[model samples]
Target: MAAPLTLLLIVAVTIRAALYRSSLVDIISERVEVVSPLTAWKRVVEGLALLDLGVSPYAGDVFHETPLIIYLFHFVIDYAEITFMLADVITAVALYMSAQEYNKQVFRKQRFALEADRYPMDCIELIRSPKEMYYIPLKVAMFYLLNPFTILSCVAKATCGLNNAVISLFILATIKGNVLLSAIFLSLATYQSIYPLTLCASALLYLMQRQYIPVNPRRASFWWFVAQYAFMYLGSLFVIVGLSFFLLGSWDFLPSVYGFMEHPVFLIFMQLAVISIFKSYPTVGDIALYMAFLPLWNHLHRFLRNIFLVSCVLLSCSALFPVLWHLWIYAGSANSNFYYAITLLFNVAQILLVSDYFYAFLRREHHLTYGLYLKRKDGSEATLVLK
Candidate 1:
């Protein structure tokens, strides 16, 4: 696994480095789909220049990145390419470890359920085996590193890659059941982008699940855990924000950096997808984050509806994005409507894909609980329908 991951990292780095040195760097950086207003490297450079001139980076409308990020690149602005590349590597490695730990927990829970004869006998085929799960971590790592979206973002030096790295670290920490690290990383991610704040509930739920804390109002232990986790998360966020304010000697970032879209949390996948699709200035890097998790649900393929159609739609839209952009911007033959149509279609395809997976997962859980073949009281076959 290490050897394969090493080779993949080297290959990913080579591709990014080549693109960084090539003439396409400017072209790639200027792409609307690859670099948004908030995460563009050029804006970061502009902000750095302002800081050097003893002016607040947020004084202008150009730079929207958080204070900590600007400070981070303040020192590493010369090696911006390496910084982006390193962020991608860190994200891939964190996701790899997270997948491994999550798989183990899933297998453990399945073993307990099987021992207790909790699952229906007809659900035997749905059980995941170690052989099938063996390479999932490597696959996850490969998905992140080899993903074209990830590569494009890295080459563009978009701060979205850095946000992805922080979110990945939060996921890794939560899966590993480290209470403090999970809170801290979650805070860091939330600080970077306000959308990540939705992850707080999910993380707390996951930690409570791991610790066997029942979600009952009567359980003192549950409330204690919730309070403790909230305190840590809020405390860390306060500290990070304070550090940023102290570094800049102003409160300008409170609005420029932290003021953005608010999202509701349903599941982690849906939350991520919503953020990517509905954020103020979305980019391909945002989409890449959620797409990496799709492989983890491959087991639900049998229950999925519209997988093929949705996949085709997504692929076609991804390919047409640049062509449509060129037509709208450069050729002037087409208009923003033409490009926006594709963008709308692309987002609709994403929504359909997410909805299909969510349905499939629920349906699989239903089958595992009841018999695969459901029957009514009259011994007639029953069909489940969404109301």
Candidate 2:
């Protein structure tokens, strides 16, 4: 396990180091497809320069990164390239560990279910085999490390990589049932970018299940768990925010860092729909992160309906994003509307893909609980309707 992961780390680092030394680093850093207003390395440098000159980084519109990142890079500016590469490695390693732990828990549950005959008799083929599950963790690490989106983000020194690293660590902590660690990392993520606050749902869900608590609103145990986690999460967030205020001596960052003015309600919902909904690289990295789980869900292939169509739409949007950006920014033949239209389509594709997976997972669970074949009142075969 360590050998392959070490090799993967070496490969990823080599690629990043080479790109950092090459001439493409500057070009890649400036490309809209690779960096956004909040995560661009250029903005961080500008912010650092401002901080050095005894001015607020956020005083001008050029720097929108959080105060923490600015302070972090304040000292490590010399090793900025190395720091980004290390962040990618940390994210990959954290994800690998989390995936391995999750797979073991899944197999344990499946084994218990089998022993208790909890599965439907006709659903024998849906049972996962050890042979098929053995390599999933390694594949997950590979998918994240070799993913072009992650590579680009790292090479461009996008601070999104650091956010991703924190999120990956949060996922790992949650899976390991470390409530304090999970809440801390979750708060850190939320502080970095408000979008991760929506991930509280998934994290709470995973934590509740790990503790064997039923997810019923009327149940005391469920509510207790929810309140406990919520308290920790919210408390940490408040502390972090208060610290940021004290450090900066102003609240100007609230609107800029959180995008409080523009689309406040819609921004939260939009970010919730696509957790990785950065302008470009972040979304792809999010897609790749989930893509690692597809093999674990191979049993769900038979249950999915629009897998192919959803995949094609996502692929087309990904391919078109760069072309549209080029035309709008360089060729001068297209406008922001054209580029934004593709961005909308891209996010729509992501939503549809995630929805398909949600459906497939639920349908598979249904088959496992009930019989795969459902009978109507008239003794005829019944089919599930998503709509």
The most accurate candidate by TM-score is 1
Give me the overall lDDT of model 1: 0.76
User: lDDT at 60 for candidate 1?
Assistant: 63
Candidate 2 worst ten-residue window by lDDT:
210-219
- Writing each residue's lDDT as its tens digit, candidate 2 over 22-62 gives 99888877766567666778888888888889999877777
Pairs clashing within candidate 1? none
Sum up the clashes in candidate 1.
0
Going through the candidates in the order shown, the clash numbers are 0, 0
CA lDDT, every model vs. true structure: 0.76, 0.68
Q: What does candidate 1's lDDT look like per residue over 86-108, in tens digits?
A: 99999999988888888887788
Off by over 4 Å in 2: 210-273, 277-283, 375-387
Query: Scored by Cα lDDT, where does model 2 land?
Result: 0.68
